[model samples]
Target: MFRQLSERFGRPVAMAILTLLGMWLMVMVTLPQLQMIDYSFRPNLLPAQLGGPEDVWTLSNYVTLFNNEIHRAIFFKTLWSSVLVTLLTLVVSYPLAYYLAKVATPRQAALCILLLIIPFWINEILRTYSWFIILAFRGPLNEILLALGLIDRPIRFLSGDGGVMVGMVYAYILFMVFPLYNAIESLDDNQIRAARDLGAGNVRTHWRIVIPHAKPGIATGCIMTFMLAAGSYAVPALLGSPGSRWFTQIIYNWFFEGGNWNQGAAYAFLLLVLCIGFMSLVMKFFKVGLGDIAK
Candidate 1:
């Protein structure tokens, strides 16, 4: 990899770029993770109790995650919810990506992409809060339904998992789309044409030809979407009711509301482990390598 980069960019420039990247990984990614791991192993200490002899390393933080029924439920709930979100995103994105990459004219595709991107220019918090208005009892959706005589009373959309799922799907749908688009756009049209000429239907053509070619992108998108959804705090917090407790909210409570940094670190580290495991599963299932994803 270094040799290829050096050949393309000249040795000095490639070396400089590699150095910067290495520093970025170490400082921005590796260092914080190592610190979190360290913190996770340490005993929780109050601000007034720092530097005391009782402040020692222990596995209690990890043990607490398992022994506590609430924590265990929340952990599993977050995992499953994230998986659901990834699958939903994939189902929603694949057709759109196929359209943008293969069917639409370049100008039309560009316009579609621009429309998708326009929402993100606003603050994420504001975007999430907009769902509140749409889902609120007297909001536009309820008002419309009432006007259409679909229901006599407004439904409690914001008080259930549906709203959270809707918000999450909307928030992270683009992550899945862009990767799928990149993979599909590179496919040669001849392969698809040949498949069609050979009497394959639209579904078969995509299942046999297009999807296989886009495996790397599918794996990449699933990994990214799953990770982001699993670690999400904002969308759930803003859109979900107290009953719709995401594991990230638990982690936030441990760190901030509960004032238990050590436990929070442990929870955060476990979440990281869950994401890594999911990525590994995706790579294996898709039969793709890390290098393929990096493309």
Candidate 2:
């Protein structure tokens, strides 16, 4: 349809029409998201008692964000944990993604890729709960450890960062794997063959050819995995120490438990902004926009 329109109406007109249509579509999607931004800064006071309607303007809500220690801690924890998770996922996923995309046979490649995707099909919450079955004191891991005489008692895997990172990596592995895999898969195998044929060894071929080609995918996978793992609530709630709460859990507390919607909105907005900024940084560094994956 676009090709026909370009021929009939001329390419520039067709481009203009498509651009306008794209903008309209974007506006439709983006307006509500922007409204969330507006709501984040909205005043918490009821304006009917003051002078006007409920949505009357005020900066009090946003100001509270800076004043709250609980809010500060949650934000920091989420940011720090996410950064660590991103680094870990990159280390774990890159080798696996590279091997699958570059070295595996057709059937082995499909099976390996399928193994990564299979867990994602399960509900995330259920997957997190499944970890409880493995890590709980009375769980199979504990039973096995005791039988092996590795410890006098069960280990507290689910009570700290160890459990949280494990669950996070489990849930987010696909995000890391798929992007890196797609990025590696798109490279021309002939380049690798030529490098090998020219007497470049395995290490040289990968270092000079494979890693450069897979850079975008690696960046994308890290960005996505970090974002999702950081913002996630249920896994942290289930796996993390109740005393050491996650940021998302804290946000939930503010919204529902604390009965402070304004503060909750502020927390959410801060998280969203941080994620966007990181994504922009990744795009700038990689010389590829987030949309490039789609392209």
The lDDT per prediction is: 0.93, 0.83
Q: For residues 1-295, write the lDDT of model 1, one tens digit per residue.
A: 7899999999999999999999999999999989899889989877777778877888999999999998899899899989999999999999999999999999999999999999999888898999888998889999999999999999999886878888888999899999999999999999999999999999999999999999999999999999999999999999989888999999999999999888999999999899999999999999999999998
Q: lDDT tens digits, residues 1-295, model 2?
A: 7899899999999999999988987798678667666767766555455444666666777677679887777678788888888888888988898889888998999998888778788898899999978999799999999999998998888776878888888889888988888989999999999999999998998889887888888788878897898789988988888755778887798789987677777778788888888888877887887677564
Q: How many pairs collide in each candidate, listed in order?
A: 0, 0
The C-alpha stretches of model 1 lying farther than 4 A from their native spots are 1-23, 47-52
The TM-score, computed over Cα atoms with residue i paired to residue i, of candidate 1 is 0.91
Error of 1 at 128 (Å): 0.6
RMSD (Cα, Å) for all candidates, in order, is: 2.4, 4.0
Best by TM-score: 1
> Which residues of candidate 2, in runs, are more than 4 Å off?
1-28, 50-56, 190-207
Residue 54 alpha-carbon offset, candidate 1, angstroms: 2.4
